[model samples]
Target: MCDRMPLLGMFPSQKRSPPLTIMNLTKLHPFLLLGSFCLASLATCDTAKANDVVGPLVGAVESTSANFLYRVGESEQPLRLSVLLDGDVVQAVDSIGRQEDDFVAKFSISNLRPDTRYHYQITNTKTGETLIEADEQHAFRTANPARHGNRVSVGFVSCVDIEPNGIWKEMQGLDLDTVCLMGDTPYIDSTDLKKVRTRHREFLQMPDLAELAANTPVVGTWDDHDFGLNNGNGHNLMEGKVDTRRGFVNYRAHSQFGNGKEGVYHRVDLGMIEVFFLDPRYFSQTEPSPVDPTQPTCFGAEQWEWLLTGLRESKAPFKVLAFGAIWEDKKNFETDDMFTYWYERDALLDVVKNENIGGVVLLGGDIHVARHLIHPQRVGYDLHDFVISPGHKRTITELDVFHPSLEWSLVEGWQFLTLTADGTQAEPTLTAEFRQPDGVVNRQVKLPLASLTAVDSSKPDSGLRAHWSFDGDLKNQSVLGDRVDAVAVNDALVVTDGGVSGGALKLDRSREQFARVPRSFLDDNSNHHTVSLWFKPTSLPAHGTSERHFLLESTAEGTESAKSAWHLSLGMRSSEDASKVNLQLFTHTLQPATEIGAAPAAKAQGGFDALVDREALLGRWNHVVLAFDSSSLTLTLNDKQIAKHPLPVPGPASEFGGLIIGGHRVGAGRNFDGWIDEVSIWQGEMPAETK
Candidate 1:
């Protein structure tokens, strides 16, 4: 048996009256007709019945707000809605039926606290009588921001169809503060306003769905199907498209359908994160071209300007931009996807880069798959894109192809994503989890927060030279003229725990694991220089061990007896006290032997050793600096000068052959074990103390 009330005026009465044709009723105002129908129904039935009122589904949930829309499925007399928050009457609104919509009643509530959970119930009253009431209390939570020193989790999904068993149950299990419906929320491909409204009513009436909707706030945007047709765009002229847009506006609270305008683009701030919901379907141009400047567009000029301005002005730690179609140009059959609109997409990216907007993550759906992408070669920092789809519909099987920036991809699955932000530290952290339909987390990735925050790279005297943070890749992040490629030896060196963020490289002691760069980049040995790095040793060579473990060495290729221009190593301070380990800095200047009277004097070496305290170099990450001035060489540990030695012979040191990390350039000995990060070489003097 259908749970829906018949819309064709099939009220039970003692005597049958002539049927009122809907066409004839068009002459009367919709509200008048609605009122007349209600009065006639009431005259034929008992007004004391409690089953006449249908629903009070919750929608348009914001970080600190909520709105409820309900309808009197059969009631004729005016009804009053009483909303209770935590057992206290917070609001009571009498139904102004047909004034807003023919049969719907809307109650908007706001000014609530963020991250707070509230339980609520709605009751329908008429003439001092309670006719309908909520079966049970429902709960909802406000969006939590990371700036409040709290962690926030948000779940997102797309492409769901009205079904007996929808994924709403699974979504509720995620315990998310807010749920984003990325589009295709309902499979209502119709042009009739009545049909669209009916589909929405049927879908929301599902038992589990009703419970979830009433308790959890839902924010959504629409795609083609929900907009009245498949591949619907700005050119859609179907009779129902306008009504579909109207229904969306009436249903969702956070949506920004411009005052008397048509687009559903809006922004919501969830504490430390700001989410921008875009209208990719309504105002989109027909068949946008990437190469032509005069062609159509995805987000028209107005929306594009609005989006860029919002992003620029937002102070949130994380910014999420969401839309209905895939952001990348997969070159599939869908011409409306972001790829075909590359010009607009690239323009947005340019603004993000040029304006120094950080924490901007792109979210999208409609592909019926889940994937993560990294566009590493973008204008500024790399852009991370995440896609989750098939919120409840059947998945489609497709082959996944390899792309340079494709981190992970999968097909034929019903899944959603949870993005959690941790803002407890100076640099906030965000973690994204891809979960299965059963609420099991399938894959997770933690992004370095510093990358999400834009930095002014144009500053001079930032003291950044050859910096290698070793964050996922080996490319130099500095602009000091030299860009060197680092190669991992034996593939044994992998990124491991222990840098400031993503982690550092772990050089296994058992294997001949090390990394190396070219000598040409660091050939400026003639100037005052400073080299600093963070390293943690698993174990220091016991006191008298003859082997010298080199953490970094810039030297000319030669046998064991050869000298290096500069090196930081752990070795015995002479064979006498071989049982004690010392962090040593070696700087040498070689001069050809000159013999006026004799044949040729042996090559003379001039240098000094600045030894660091051995105890500070083991177990924990220690910041060591080897700085050189014209007259002296200094070794600092954790910003405090520990050792200083006057240069025995220092005019201008000669250039070394190559730079080797974790070991010597030419030998397997002097291998370093453990973690190393933030290796930098400066061509000027370094201060004894740094923040």
Candidate 2:
């Protein structure tokens, strides 16, 4: 079956009538012609009934859920409803009474899981025995949890209309936690209930969306078309703000948008990450870009204040500030399609800079194209900006290059970002190698935290360290088998063996293993302190189960016994070859334990690898440092700070006991087999890297 409804041409009737020929029109009496038309109308109605007429896509949200407004057809009949989960029928309702032209029915599904998928459909109850005969399944996912980690992937889209294949395929592969629809999901250009129903129904049939809804979590807000007439502003709706409010009401009822207040903006946590969804239409004052300060506002007074406060108070490591408008630094007024409202943008930017906040990312979609921008200046707070726009439905034209700080622009093609984070550092590496749907190749750029901080330094005191640090094996200054460049060249502290190369660092494997160890190991004197390190192995295996390496302390001796002065050493797995990270900071009997970390690939340069493999790590070098304050621990890698958290500092009890680097493993009680150097420990925090 094609699974599509036949469109009613020029005029719609309950029944199909034979096309009238010239002879029939000329010879037929008026009465006879009228009778034939009446018969045809009846037949058309019968066929519609037999085919299971499906119309109206109502969405309602209320106290008990049934109270939500519904987008229903103006028909005097009850509907058969079937709710599904991933194309499987879960619940069905039948034998409902016919509703008046304006009436709506109600049902509630409680006990729904947050961030999960589901499907549903409705049919004419009077004509079919099944609750919903051949009703196509529409999919949906719940909202995210409130608190999560530092990294998250979210999808945004707008300007959606009836199309050949749907956006769902592209959506599913992204593996996102949430989907933000920035308007035009349905292209309803009229206030007429029928037009809205038709558009909604067609959208429900989109398989891509149906599948997506059944799987990923979804959050939607409206734009002009779905809410009102073309280019709709709040004042233009039929019921004005009332209609706008109702549309939102219906949208919320259908989607997983949380409902304390009725509008689109809301915040939720996905794992360790938190996100704030913005609703610009309802509260917005400006229609087009050059925002009129004297005119009404967008985001209204209340929303503006709320957003400001929310951004300031957010505890998540990363924040995604999003909107519907285009955010191009340089505008093309001739196209009349660029972000507006500079005053508002500046206000938001001001809040971020002044707050001394980190990990804030901006997102938006509207141009029907994907774009990425890295602001050399953080607009307000000497901060750098990383912004991306991945639009939907439209085939991208060319790759656009933008270097605001460098002052040049290039059109490479459409692009996306693969961002990685580990509490301390987050890297957004652009891979232009991945083509857009239209098959255009773009360039990929990698941006590290170190670069961003130096380029966008807002603080006057540039002397303090960033936040984290790394101290690996005592080889050269590099963490991996790379050469030791100067602090000016590469800011991280250096650890190196006396000679060039020719030695292997092996782990003391025979011992008990704890997924995470505390920094108390360094507190030999029972005093509290934090410790961190970065390491590189001479050789690595892609797949294996045994063979471990050590760059720092181990607890293989025994769980409770701190027996031997020959306490512990660090560890690394040979299977994970290349480079690795070990960051542990713990308190003594008095305080708490906290850790922050990240590991980069060990790059081979010059005679580094060759010498390290055959001789002492001559060309190879690694950095190892232990910096602690009485209350906190800080770790860094390659000069880029990693994490700073409260923990028990190393004690003075170890003054009599020697500090060991490649000593015996903690639990295994075996010695580490690797070259060591540049071992340094400070009673105070290490000096901050240069901006």
For candidate 2, lDDT tens digit of each residue in 1-691? 1122222222122123222223433454554334223211111222232112222232321111211122233344555556566667665554232342223344345454555555555555666432222233334444444343234555556666654332345556666555556566666766666556446545543434534543354555666667655545544452554444444444343433324443566654443345566665555533322333443454656667667777777765556666555444222321111223334554566466556565565655444455554432342222323233333334433424222222122222223333333233344321212223333334344434333332233343221211112233323221111111111111212233332243222332232211212122121222333344434434332234444444444232222225432222334333233333223332222211121111111111111011112122223555545444534444454454555544333222221122334433243332333343333332224434421
Q: Which stretches of candidate 2 lie over 4 Å from their true place?
A: 1-152, 188-194, 224-232, 235-263, 286-296, 329-339, 377-691
RMSD of each: 18.6, 20.5
lDDT of 2 at 563: 42
Q: How far is candidate 2 from the true structure (C-alpha RMSD, Å)?
A: 20.5
Highest TM-score model number: 1
> What TM-score does prediction 1 earn?
0.58
